[model samples]
Target: MGSFQIEGGHRLSGSIQPQGAKNEALQILCAVLLTSEKITINNIPDILDVNKLIRLLTNLGVKVEKTGKGSYTFKSDDLDLDYLHSEQFKIDGSGLRGSIMIVGPLLARFGKGYIPRPGGDKIGRRRLDTHFEGFIKLGAKFRYNKEDRFYGVEAPKDGLKGSYMLLEEASVTGTANIIMAAVLAKGTTTIYNAACEPYLQQLCQMLNSMGAKIGGVGSNLLTIEGVEELKGCEHRILPDMVEIGSWIGLAAMTRSEVTIKNVNWNMLGVIPNTFRKLGITIEQQGDDIHIPAHTNGYEVQSFIDGSIMNISDAPWPGFTPDLLSIMLVVATQARGSVLIHQKMFESRLFFVDKLIDMGAKIILCDPHRATVIGHDFKSTLKATTMSSPDIRAGISLLIAALSAKGTSVIHNIEQIDRGYENIDERLKAIGAKIERIA
Candidate 1:
């Protein structure tokens, strides 16, 4: 495992562009399997998980060509069907949770889809029940192999017939997988309680551009009229909202003046306002967000009722659970206290212990909540060694370390690399003293 040795107390000042949406890239890349023609996708993030999925596609004999730095053309005309059922595919497919999305498009085109138990951050129990239930509702037979620990979905002789499904919860990946499968099914499919995040909306728009009939864009209820076949089309992914939020938190923690360029501000629902509530100065300049240096120290804003502020995560248009850790870490330097409630994932708040050890006043109220008493830059954080628990926590720890008084070593950087594209180099561009050591 590699580690990042970061020297603290540097004010980063520059403009940086956020990478392409990792989640959207996963969805778009998997959508390539829905057609046999060449699909050109631009603004693909070159990260570990995305690259792993691309390699998986190549292993299945899809013709992949690199058009530019973050562009690719994928043609699935000669897929190796036998490889999908082999043992090797099971091992390869388990590397990332996003790999599970491949099943939808494959089942839509080939009548069969198989995937091993997916792997990702051990934040909490991520259930695949929603995905299987969606497929089952679409007239596909589902089965699980006890010994092999893999799931398989096979279409009936008549193929998939569209139906209405009200999802139990708005699971992003689950909604995406079902959407991919439903676009090619027979008749019409109505998905209520669908995730309307920008990434899913991008997926629906891309599929529609590829000759699929999907209505109700940017809303919870999606109506997809099943088409006989889908053709490939060109699509460009938007900036990663999670990464943009992380950069905002990083700029505040380091007391830096950094501008995030080319950010699609409209797609970022509550991210900008969430950080603004922490008393960080956010200015919108055209398509960019400028985070001015908080030299006077940031003060957390209280609720209108004079109660302690609460930052919580909900489905869409709410604060994302992925950035809760970043919010907690940023709150450590603010002037007031706030309640950080991580409702979605149980184990995510456990990383607050590491922040507390670095001189931040944080109380781990429970596995799902933490109360942060802002230090307000009165005491500089004392650097220490820590292990990254997950992707968001890793970046949060990096932010904390960058603002600390001494050097800190963060191990398990692979977790960070799985999501962020060239994070160290990007930080270096903004004058951060981070070194990657193997």
Candidate 2:
């Protein structure tokens, strides 16, 4: 396992560009299997998870070519359907959670799709029932091999027939998977209570451009009319909003002046304003976000009734759960206390013990919530060695280390690399003292 050696108490300046959206890239990559024509994708982040999915596609006989840095052209003219049942595929497909998405496209275009139980962050129980359930609603037969922990879905002899589905929960990945499958069904498919995140909207728009008929691009109700076949088109991914939020928190925690370029401001939803609630200054410079140096510590805002401030995650138009770890870390040095409620995942707040060891005052009320008492920068966190548990927690720990007193070592940094692209180099460009130790 590789580690990161970080020298703390350094202020970072200059500008950093967020990489292509990791979540969107996963969905878009899977959509390439929906068509056999040449599909060119730009702004593909060179991260471990995305790369793993690309390799999985390559092994399945999709022709992939590198056109430029962060750009690739893929053609699914030929595919090895038997590879889906191979032992090698079982091992490769189980490496990342994104591999589950490929099943939808394969079942839609071809007749069958199979996948091993996917593996990802150990944050909590991430069920695959939503994806499989959606596939079943689209007239596909589902089966599970408990002994092998594998899932298989096959379309009917007449192929997939569109139907209306009201999801029990608004899941982003589940919605994307069902949308891909429905695009090639026999009739109209209506999905209610769907996730309307910008990335999902991008997926729908890309499908529309590729000859699919989709309505309600940015709403909870999506209507997809089945097309005989889909053609290929060029698509560019948006900047990762989660990474942009992380940079915002990093700037405030270390008292640095950093500018995040080409952030696609309108699509950021409540991210910028949510940071503002923590008393951080976020300036919009055209399409970029400029966070000036917080020479004095920031203060948390209270409710209109003078109650303590509380930040929680919800569906779209609400604060994202991905950045809650960053918010918890940033609140350590703020001027007042704020409550962080992580509603989606249970184990995400377990990393607070490491921060508490670093001299931050945080009360882990339970698996779902924590109250962070800010030191207001009067006390600096003392550096310590730690291990990264997941992607978001890893970056949060790295931010904490960068703002601490001495040097710190983070083991199992592969968790971080799975998401961020060249994170150490990118931080170095903004004057952050981080080194990757192999």
Candidate 3:
């Protein structure tokens, strides 16, 4: 396993640009399968997960060309449908969670789609029931192969018929999958309780640009009118808000002055203000976020009634669950304590043990909650070795290491690579003392 050897307690400065939204890229790339013409996508992150999906598409006979850095052209005019059932496909499709999204477009246009149980971060139980159930509501037949642990959805020979569905949960990927499938159905498809995150909204807008009739682009309820076929369109992904949050936390933890450039501020709902709740200074300068050095150290804000702060994740327009790990780590250095409730994923909070070992005060209340008591910078964390449990946790630990005294080693960095693009190099550019050890 690769590791990051970091010399801690150093302040970082200068500007860094956030990569394209990884979540949006995954869904948008899958949409390329809905059309037979050339689709050019720009600002695609050079991350492991996105690259894996691109290769998977190539394997399925989509003609792909690299136009420039972080830009690619894809044409799925002809695809090898048989490859979907091949053993090699099982191996390829099972490597990343994003692979599950391809099934929707394939089933929409080609009548059948199959995928091996997809693999990704072992955070919690991310059920596929939402995606398949939505498909079933649209008149697709669902089946599972017990022996191979494979899933298949096939539309009738007449094609899928649009229907209304109320999702059990507002799952981003699940919502995107259902929308992709519904875009090609015979009638209007209505989805309630759908995820309305910026990435999902981007997917809906992209589909609309491709001749799909979609309404309520940024709301929980979505309406899609089925079309015969989609035409190719050019799309540019927005900057990743998760990475922007990470950089903000990293700046606060290391007491650095860092500017995150071209953040598309209007799209970052609740993220900037959420960090402000922890008493971090976030300045909106043009389209960038400028976090000044917290030389005097930041403090946590109490509730209106003087109660200890409580931070939790919810659907869109709420603080994202993905950044809870970063918030938990940032809270460790604040003046007051906060309760982090990770309701979406059970095991995500389990990583607190690693932070606790690094000399930060934290209480793992249960699988879903953690109470973190800040050190107020009166006591700095001691460097130690730790293993990354997941993507967000990995970056959180890296931030902790950068603020801790002495040197620290973080193993299993591949988890971080699956999400962040060239994290070590990016840190180095901002004067961070980090090295990649292969």
Candidate 2 residue 166 Cα shift, in angstroms, is: 0.4
* lDDT (Cα) of model 3: 0.95
Quote model 2's TM-score.
Answer: 0.99
- Residue lDDT tens for model 1, 1-438: 999999999999999999999999999999999999989999999999999999999999999999999999999999998988887798789888999999999989999999999998989999999999999999999999989888999999899989999999999999999999999999999999999999999999999999999999889999999999988899999999999999999999999999999999899999989988989889999999999988998999999999999999999978889899999999999999999999999899888889889989998888999999998898989999999999999999999999999899999999999899999999999999999998
Per-residue lDDT for 300 in model 3? 92
Q: Write the per-residue lDDT of candidate 3 for residues 1-438, one digit (tens) a residue.
A: 899999999999999999999999999999999999999999999999999999999999999999999999999999999999899999999999999999999999999999999999999888999999999999999999999999999999899999988999999999999999999999999999999999999999899999999998899999999999999999999999999999999999999999999999999999999999999999999999999999999899999999989999988888999999999999999999999999888788888889999888998888999999999999999999999989999999999999999999999999999999999999999999999998
Question: Alpha-carbon error at 352 in model 1, in Å?
Answer: 1.1
Per-residue lDDT of candidate 2, residues 274-337 (tens digit): 9999999999999999999999989999999998899999989778899999999999999999
Model 1 has an lDDT value of 0.94
Model 3 CA RMSD to the hidden true structure, in angstroms: 0.7
**Scored by CA lDDT, what does every candidate get?**
0.94, 0.96, 0.95
Query: How do the predictions measure up, each by TM-score?
Result: 0.99, 0.99, 0.99
RMSD of 1: 0.7
In every candidate, how many clashes are there? 0, 0, 0
**Candidate 3, superposed: residue stretches over 4 Å from native:** none
RMSD of each: 0.7, 0.6, 0.7
Clashing pairs in 2: none
